[model samples]
Target chain A: MTAQALHQHQPHRPEDGHKLHGYPPGDLAIWVFILAELGAFFVLFTVYAFTRLKHLQLFAEMQRTLDSDAGMINTLLLITGSWCVARAVAAIKRNHCRASAHWLLAAIGSGVGFLIVKYFEYGAKFAAGINLDTNLFYTFYIALTAFHAMHVVLGMAILLLVWKKAMAGGYSAQDHHGMETGASYWHMVDLVWIILFPLVYVMR
Target chain B: MGVHFLNVIWVALMVATVLTWLIGKTGELSTAMVVAVLVISAVKGWLIIYDFMALRRVRLLWRGLVLGWLLLTLSIILLAYWLGIK
Candidate 1:
């Protein structure tokens, strides 16, 4: 579809039930799913906190053995990636499909960077004989960060799909639910890391 | 114009991250510093949700749902941390 086709697209459709219901962005179904995911993480984080409190000294020592620099870099990557996704959504909202695709690609690059930093960080820990069974701190550390890393991979895949569709002019200023859905999911991943980084790595 | 706004937010988030990292590097387990870090995390989370996720444009109910969850999660974590410090 060309710019002309997108421009001809419905700029505003009140009957779509979105504005009628004063709905949130993206699919309402996605918002429900996103909340469920966040709820799971919330439970994990709460468990981590109380458990760490039980063994503060051990947690503190184990945390020090991890790589803060890598964690910091990964944090930066995810934040930038989230920003890029936001830009991608913004672009498509204005009927700029190609620009949106470009922004999605930039976001994907950030996702790749995050995974690379995470790979080396995990590798270093494993090489140090620090396995998941190492201790309490190591256990939650591996579990939380590893779970989040997997989400990053999933987010990347979703972003790739969004990118391919955007490149094909599948979204427009009026109908870009797919992009918002993917972007919302990606931002959740970023949000998880935001809390994880400080809670696990910095709050020692 | 919107892109510029998002860029400004990105910069703010980066600066906040760096500041938190520097504070962590101080190696201080002081309650004050921990509180500061948690506060920063909340702010970062809010920015991503409100702007990046575009929750600001949504209805009050949805905003409340997300932000309420955030507040609850952060408060619990902080409470646990404070207890651990004691």
Candidate 2:
């Protein structure tokens, strides 16, 4: 509220952080979508936990049969990707477009690596004569992980677009919604994987 | 110390995995191990969300949203475990 601040150039569009007043509508949308998503996943997880608990011995047996190593490695990869994305955001804010591009690419690449690892893990499960229909526990394992895998795919796509937009100068130091959106989605992927790793892989 | 730090987490995670297996194998350690696993996993989950999700810097409401899900998830998991044994 400076006396000389009456001539500020306000952004009319709502996509950018500056609106007529308060936060951008897009940010609100993203938060609403995120909240809704958490609710959906919460419901799914509650049901999964209930069923797994109802069949604890079977779930434990199922977990005992699966390999935990692969899951651990995937966890490491996604976390590294998260670090890269964070650096990307920092670089973008610092006006280092090229460096930001590299970080976004690395984030996308690591996301791909995560999925590749997931494929191998799933492939091994299938190869070793295990599947969703085999038992109640496998049903939850497959369903949850498969849903997470799909999110990973979606996140990578968003990251790729972020990379492209950054290169085209679609974002400046002051306005980088694409980067923010990408990181938020990527973190969602990482969060889901965190739950998946312990619940589906380790806890049992 | 940054790279070294994340590397340490990587190591800690590996060790936790081995420790989980050891506890699982000990049989006598299963119940305690299960509780330990849940607690350790909760810590590790926060590491990922705060360090990785970039939630540490955001508004408190954002952190609250993530934690809300975690608490719900934990309570349900406990209920499920209890039901399975009963």
Candidate 3:
């Protein structure tokens, strides 16, 4: 479908206005889940910040041992993945199933790239005899990142399912709630990393 | 959002990511630098929440909830930094 055709089918009429204005793009259940996930991360982030206040020197010293370059690359990957997913959602809304599937595949590829980088990073740290019990800083570093990495894995799985559906022509302009739901979850993953990269890697 | 606008946001986000990376690489520990990094993070989070998450057209309550999460989280981090400097 052309852009003009897609615009004509948009659910923006007076009757649909209430629907668009009331909730977000995805399902209410997904939004609830997102809020719960964010709440958990909020607590973890707060604890890390306050804990750093008590051991500033320890955090500063241990942080130096980290590879900021890898963190930056992971940030880029997640950001790109997010953009691709957004593009996928946009494509599907225009009833372009093939294009949406391609975009989703690209997003999944970015997720794979992130995992590869994170794997090497973890390998290097373990090679240096560093473990969760290395110290307070290393403990937080490993725990926090490992937790976030788990979320990335889950996000990729969700994306994979969405891709399969998109490829099967399961979604269209009037019925893409699943795509938006998955996209929202993926964006949440990216959102957490946006804060995690700076709080854990950059901020001294 | 249009694909073109999303592309623009993607480029802007990449630039901001590189800037944050450069700032971290400088290895200068100062209050100003810390604030700069946190502020950059806040802006990035806002973009993801509002634009990428497609919350911009939603009700004010939902938008406020997500934005509030970002603001509150960053504020706590900033407060911690302030306490550290004390």
User: Which one is best on lDDT?
Assistant: 3
Tens-digit lDDT string for candidate 1 (A7-61): 3322222234335225556666667778998999999999999998889889888
What is chain B's TM-score across the candidates, in the order shown? 0.93, 0.71, 0.95
Query: What is candidate 1's CAPRI-style docking category based on DockQ?
Result: medium
Candidate 3, residue A39: CA error in Å? 0.5
Which candidate, 1 or 2, would have the higher lDDT against the true structure?
Answer: 1
Tens-digit lDDT string for candidate 3 (A1-204)? 354432233332123533545667766677788999999999999999999989989999889889999999999999999999999988887788999999999999999999999999999999999999999999899999999999999999999999999999999888887888899999999999999999998988
Candidate 2 Cα outliers beyond 4 Å, as residue runs: A1-26, B1-29, B82-86
Tens-digit lDDT string for candidate 2 (A116-202): 888888898899888879888888888888888888888898889889998887766677766776777777777666666767677
Candidate 2 chain A lowest-lDDT run of ten: A17-26
Q: Is candidate 1 or candidate 3 better by DockQ?
A: 3
Off by over 4 Å in 3: A1-20
Higher-scoring candidate on TM-score, 2 or 3: 3
Ranking by TM-score: 3, 1, 2
